[model samples]
Target: MRFLRRHVDAVYDALTVRRSRFVRVEELVIRAAGVVPGLVPTPQEIAAEDGSIQRDKSGLEIDQGLFLSAVLGSERCGRHLCHAMLLPRPEAQALLAQFERDGRVKLDGASVHRAGKAAVVTQDNPRFLNAEDQTSLDGAEICVDLALLDPTTEIAVMRGAVVEHPKYKGRRVFGAGINLTHLYHGRIPFVWYLQRDLGYVNKIYRGLAFADDAPPDEFGGNTIEKPWIAAVEAFAIGGHCQVLLVMDYVLAERSAFLTLPARKEGIIPGAANMRMPRFTGDRIARQAVQYERRLDCDSPEGRLICDEIVETGEMDAAIERVVKGLTNSGVVSAAGNRRAFRIAQEPLDMFRAYFAVYAREQAYCHFSPALIANLERYWNAQSRKP
Candidate 1:
């Protein structure tokens, strides 16, 4: 075992120096034996230890230990010397075989070519589709091919598009793009839940609260105004338009259709519907335009906030369909979209009142750390007063 250990160390060292070389198992053993005196164990001895060597297997049966020792030394140098020492030749071969099977082993050019050919044969099957269909399918197929060549290619493409597109260049466009990108990438799943599931219930709560607590003078006040809204909206609309254009460029380059405008009305349509249920309905299409609040998914109102949720689920789908029908019939948008939106007094009032409450809630939440410290000080002062 000591002889084998020293030989393994020598083989590891050799592997680090000539990592690019394709060394045979016998060659590695010969080199390792030369480095460590009295370490030249016979083939029979190796077979006895590993139980994998056949009587007829002579003249360079692959020494998995040598290969592994080399690989470890090449990849991590001396850091894995202890691990290499523990793993015997047969054990190492078994591990190498497993790595190869799992596609975890790095391939040289010839190996890569062989694998690529096999993948091409498997994936590029013949189809009886028409020319138009074939053309449409080609883009995704090409994407797959590129992905095989380089896994990070898609991310690179998206990053490049975001940086180069005019809409993504400006502050407004960048900010909106960031928000949309975060949502699309599932970075803010909570927002979707809130808007889709509990929106309507919260809207009712807010409206009732507003009517009961707020004065009539608060009705038409510019309480919603904020300096950041205009900039953020502009950026969002511009970024959305740009992204649409990029997608078109890649997917439908020759087509000249326009994307729907990003709603810059200081609210996400779906989220606003949480405050104004009558306007959005259960489908929540208009809520896309009113993205003001973080969506929560745990509540019942949150179920209809997203496109997939609204389209497929039982209650959500049914509500969405009805809303779509009404919109198509011009019942919802008859008085011009803006004027129609303002027609529902009760829901709108509720939405505004809820917005105010939400803002206050956020403010208090933000100040919680300071508030706690202040409370402690006040308690101490009260003790002295008594």
Candidate 2:
């Protein structure tokens, strides 16, 4: 622990130092840890609290806070500590290049529409119920970056694109979560999610992109100080449900249900582990994330995650009402207020350190034999056609 405590920053510093090549996830984490080492925990810590500084298990005492908690009380975008992980790296670049070269998609599965002060980000992959794939991740990154970058976009609303299938009519879904098909086939890269969570999703929560002189993590850079409202309907599955925890407010249809499905899927649920507890508290978060418990948007526990439950077909009106209501003050304190709340409730340092654990451990669970077996038994993923 002593050795790690001393060298942890050096490892992070060395790992994040500009390089021509992107390091492998586990390699980067382990190499950075040095002597008393461990991979970044991809799931929630097997046994650590959010702000906790230490833990002991398997006869090993571990502490990464010396380096990982650098974001606490610091204005620095937690990104600096995690090494700008959200930025597309080498593998991401190549995959995007190949996808484009094949003419596979014109849009990365996400589109942004602006009207007045609101920016609507539609996650459009109806074939997968708006499930996220590499393209979708890239698209979300682009859309979110666009929303944050546009000074006129005061509030961003995230929703899924219309589903083409007859089964669901034309109703939109918020998201279906990670693309299990791509994941089962090994097409979704680890960094895809890393970048999604740290890169764009955090950008949604933090409200800033690239501006050289924006004061550490300030929301400048031609950026708007925006708070996001999640408009959820139909299926809000897995990573879909996970992201709601980060939103400023959620307007959901009464018919909508939320679930992590992580227990069945055999991989991590992005940053849900870190942020879910803040909305639903520890017990509900555990039940939702660990047991695959489902919450109806109108339920008491669901209300904690969702601010207002609109009638089944009224999500559109609810979204407009909520967005207009929020911006009614028009003072632009949303960003500062959001920052204040996060600092008190779920500080960036705790999240950064949690990512350190999530980065390594989630990789293990992603490819574990148990994951395949769980999918076979629960999702029938073995027999389901992509």
Candidate 3:
């Protein structure tokens, strides 16, 4: 671990200092690959294999994966990477200025509208039922950053915009998870999973790390943060369900359901394995993540994770009432209380340890033959158009 940490630190510092910006996991991996050949597949090989690089063919890749996992597992390096990712994104300052002036910022795939004391982030991939893809990710993260940084906003609300899909036209869908079509079509990269979990999703959970020199609240440093609320209309599936786990309050329409079908997808469901057990016990979490257990929003099991379930048309009113209630008394201590609860439940060290295992294992899963087979078998992925 110490050896791996030294290498990680050297490469991390070189990339960030030379580039004058924080390094993303993919960029770090690319730099590390120059030092260690065969650590990752070449573009030509990836194109030949359509992103599913067979793991058993290379001992170098396996050993390198384990080495990277150890580096992430180490407390010092893991915390360093986590803190770096939480720093405000490079585009954030410009986006925040626009948001402040117009009270909104609309991007290609998502948008943020300042509504009263809440910043509402609407996922807008309507044709795909608001599924997240490479196109939507950056926009979503920028929106989230503006929401948390806005001084006038006391809380954040996340929901999906109305859709263009035939079956669900004119109706809002919470999200369909990762764009499986893109995954099957080789558009979703391996590091994308890591970037999502460690970047914006973690920001939603832990808030923004404002200073490069200081740590997050869990590490005894200050952060600019606000409570987040999730509104689920149709359903929250796969990665979308993972998002609900980190939300402070979840409001779902009575007909909505939640699911984490990682088994069918043949990938880790982000941090769902580590966090869902807190909401649903070990047995249920296992059943959901491994066996595709669906929980209806109004059901007893679903109510454990969902704070409130409202009738279809009642959602707008419910959101208004909840936002007002959360801020009516002033959210002076919201950030502190949230940090206190997180430190007690999922301190940064625990998350680091879990990701150590996830980092290596999910890499294998992403490039595995099984992933392709599972997508075709369960999702009919081969027939879907990207």
| Local error of candidate 3 at residue 163 (angstroms) | 1.1
Q: Which residues of candidate 2, in runs, are more than 4 Å off?
A: 1-106, 209-224
Please, what is the whole-model Cα lDDT of each candidate in the order they appear? 0.26, 0.65, 0.83
Worst 10 residues of 3 by lDDT: 53-62
> In model 3, which residue pairs have backbone atoms overlapping below 3 Å?
none
The total of clashing pairs for model 2 equals 8
lDDT of 3 by residue, 33-83 (tens): 665565455444445655442332332334445555765776666677777
Deviation in Å, model 3, residue 332 alpha carbon: 0.7
TM-score quality measure for candidate 2: 0.75
lDDT, candidate 2, at 250 = 88
By TM-score: ranked, best first: 3, 2, 1
Q: Residue 52 of candidate 3: its Cα lDDT? A: 47
Candidate 3, residue 48: Cα displacement in angstroms equals 7.7
TM-score of each: 0.18, 0.75, 0.91
Query: What is residue 257's positional error in candidate 2, in angstroms?
Result: 0.7
